[model samples]
Target: MTETLAETTPHSDEPIPAYPMPRASGCPFDPPPAAQALHDELPVAKVRMWDGSTPWLVTRYGDGRALLADPRVSSQSTLPGFPHPNAGFRENAERRRSFIAMDDPEHARIRRMVTAPFAIKRVEALRPSIQKITDELIDGMLAGPNSADLVSALALPLPSLVICTLLGVPYEDHEFFQEKSSLMINRYSSAEDMIGASDALTDYLDELIGVKLAEPADDMLSELATRVGSGELTRREAASMGVLLLIAGHETTANMIALGTVALLENPDQLAVLRETDDPKVVAKAVEELLRYLTIVHNGRGRVALEDIEVGDATIRAGDGIIIYTGTGNRDPELFPEPDRLDIGRDARRHMAFGFGVHQCLGQPLARVELQVVYGTLYRRIPTLRLATGAGQLPYKHDGLVYGVYELPVTWDA
Candidate 1:
C-alpha cells in the first residue's frame, strides 16, 4: 500500500531538511515544528544526518511502531550502514556492544540474566524503599536552602543512590561513573573521548565484577557474578552488562524526575490534576501521560534495514539507514486526541516513550514505580512547589542522548 521513492519524488528538486532539527523556542516541550510539519505532509521522508547519510525519518505513530517491531529492521550499530547518532557514537558502536545493540537470541540471552530483578512484581516490591529514598531526599532539601537546584538535591542523587545500591556499586564513587556516562552520551564528544569513557567504565566494572565474584551479595551484580563463575557468561560480558544497567538505570529516570517536575510546574491545570489525585490508578495514568508528553529520548532510535521493507510511502531498501523519531510519533494526532496537550486522564500506555517490541525498556517497571511515588509524594508534601525561573530561561539537554533540564531551580513554602 506504500509508495516507493521513485513514485513520490520523481520531479523533486528541493533539498531535504536536515535531521535533529531544533525545537521552537516558544514551545520547548514539543518536538521540532519542522519535523512535525513533515508528519503532516510526508510521514516518512528522508533527512540527512550528521554523517551525511540520508535515513528515512519516520514521524507517523503507526509507521514508527511498525518499523520498530519489524524484524527486517535491525538495531545493530555495527552494521555497515547503521545510522549512528554522531561521530562519537559511530566510533564506539562496535566497541561497546551492550545487549541494547544486539539482535534477538543473543540479546535475549543476556537480557534474561537481569530481567528477573526488574520484573513488575520485583520492582513493585522496591516501592517502599524507593519511597523512603524520595522522602529522605525531600527532607534534606527542605532542611537546607529555601532555593536549591533540584538536579543535584533530589533529581540526580535519588536515582544515583537507588541504582548504586541495586548494582552494589559504591555510591561514594558516583562522580567517576557519572562523568564517564556523561561523556559517553554527549553529542559533541569526540570519537577518542567516547572510546576513553567506554574503556574507563568497562575497566571499573571489570574490577567490581571481580569483587562481586569473590564476595557475593544480594544484588544484581552478584547475580551476574554468579553467572560468570558458573561459566554461563564471560567476565567481560558480565562487566558490560553492569556498565549498561548502571548508566541506563539512573540517567533516564533522573532526567524524567527533573523534567517531569518542570513540566508539571509549567502546566498548572495538569499539575492540579496530579496534586489532587490520591488514587494509585490516577497517579499511574499521569506518569504515562507525562512520558508521552515529554518523550525524553529526543534522538531517534537508529536502525539498518536487513531487507527491503515498505512503510507508508517509501520502500526502505536493504542497507538503508532508519531513524524512528519517537518524540514526533508520540505526538501524532492519530494516536492521541489533542496530542500536543498533556492530559493526565488519557490512556497513554501505548506511547513509545520506552520504545516498543523486544527492545522496550527493561527497567520501565522500576521507572514507573519511582515516578508514581515521586509525583504522588512530592506535590502532596510540598503543595506550593513551583519553578524559581521561567521555563524558557531554563537550559535543556538538547545536546545529549536524553532530553531533560540541566538544572531545575525550584522553590516551595517552608
Candidate 2:
C-alpha cells in the first residue's frame, strides 16, 4: 500500500473532509458531491466521522465490493472503532445488537431462523397478494381525488400493509409503528428519542408474540413464537427481530418507491419506457435501473477491520473503521457506462443498490417484486400521473439515514 499525504488524507495532520459532506445544491438524487469526489480521487482513504474518529471511506465500486466481502472485515457494532450509522445507534450499540451487527457464525445462526419467509420462491408466491394490495391502494387513490400525496397514498402504506400481513401485525396500528420507525430512522434523532422508540416497539412486539404463542397463526411471527416456545430463541430476541423486520421491511422499500416515482416523473423520457410497456421483463429492468439510479441507502455501509488489509493505495489496519459508499459505487463509470444516466433498457442487474455481501438487504426480492408491480401497473393504469408540485419544492430526506422524499404530491387525469 503506497500511503499518500494529501490534505484530505485521513492519516495526515491536514484538514480532512467530514464523513457526510453536504450534497451539492442541485443534485438531490446523487450522493454528496464531496463524498462522490472521493470515489474517483481518494477511493480508499480515511475521513473524519462525527465523533472525530477517522475511518477509511471506501468509495470506489470494486474496492467497496472487495472490502464488504473480505473476511478480515467485521460488522460487529459492539467493536470499539465500528462506524455506526448515527450517534443514537452508536450510543445504544450494545442494547440494539442484532444479527445484522454480528459477523458470520452467530449472524448466520440468527438470520437463518427468519430466512424462510424472505426466500425468493416464497416471496414470489406472494406476488398475487402484493399485486392485490397494490391494486387496492391505487383504486383507493384514483377513486378518492384528482390529486394526492403519493407517499401516504401508495409508497408508505403499500409496504406497511404487505409486511403487516406477513408478520401478523395489525395494519390498524401502522401509525404507532410508523411514527416510532421514523424516529429511529432519522440519522440525527436524539439518543433518547431513538432509544425510546426502540423500547416502545419492542414492548409492542413482545405482546404481539405472546398472542401468537397462545393462538398460533400461519404467519412469520407465529414461527418466531414457536421458536421462543422451543427454547431456541428468547422472548426479547424474538421481539428485537420483529422490530428490525417491521422497520426495515417498509422504510427502505417505501423510500425507493416514492423516490423512484419522483425521479421517473422528472425524467419523462424514462417514464415513457414504463408507461408504454406491459412486459414484466421491461418493468423488472426499470426497477433495477431505478434502484441503481436512486440508490436510496446513501449514508454508506459501515464496518470495522479485524485485521490489516491492503486496499488500493491504503492499508486499513486492525481496529480501524470503514464506511463503503455503495450508492456512489453504483454510479461507477467503469462498471456501468453512462452510469449517471438512468437507462431502463440497459441490463443493470449488477448494481450494488442492495449491497454486495452477506449483509445485503434480506428483503431485496420482495422489494424488487413490489417495485416491478408498481412500475408496471401504476403509470399504465392511470397513463396520466404527474407531479402536482415542482420537484425542487418537495422535501427530501437528506437528514434521515435513508434517502427519500417526505411527500410526493402527484396527480392524474380522470
| Candidate 2: Cα lDDT at 332 | 88
List TM-score per model, in order.
0.96, 0.96
Which residue segments of model 1 deviate by more than 4 Å?
Answer: 1-11
Q: State the lDDT at 72 in candidate 1.
A: 89
Q: Which tens-of-lDDT digit does each residue in 38-86 have in candidate 1?
A: 8888888888888889888898889989898999889899998898888
Clashing pairs in 2: none
Angstrom error of the Cα, residue 73, model 2: value is: 0.7
Candidate 1 lDDT at 342 equals 87
Q: Write the per-residue lDDT of candidate 2 for residues 88-129, one digit (tens) a residue.
A: 898778886778898998899999998888889999999999
TM-score of 2: 0.96
Model 2 ranges with Cα > 4 A deviation: 1-14
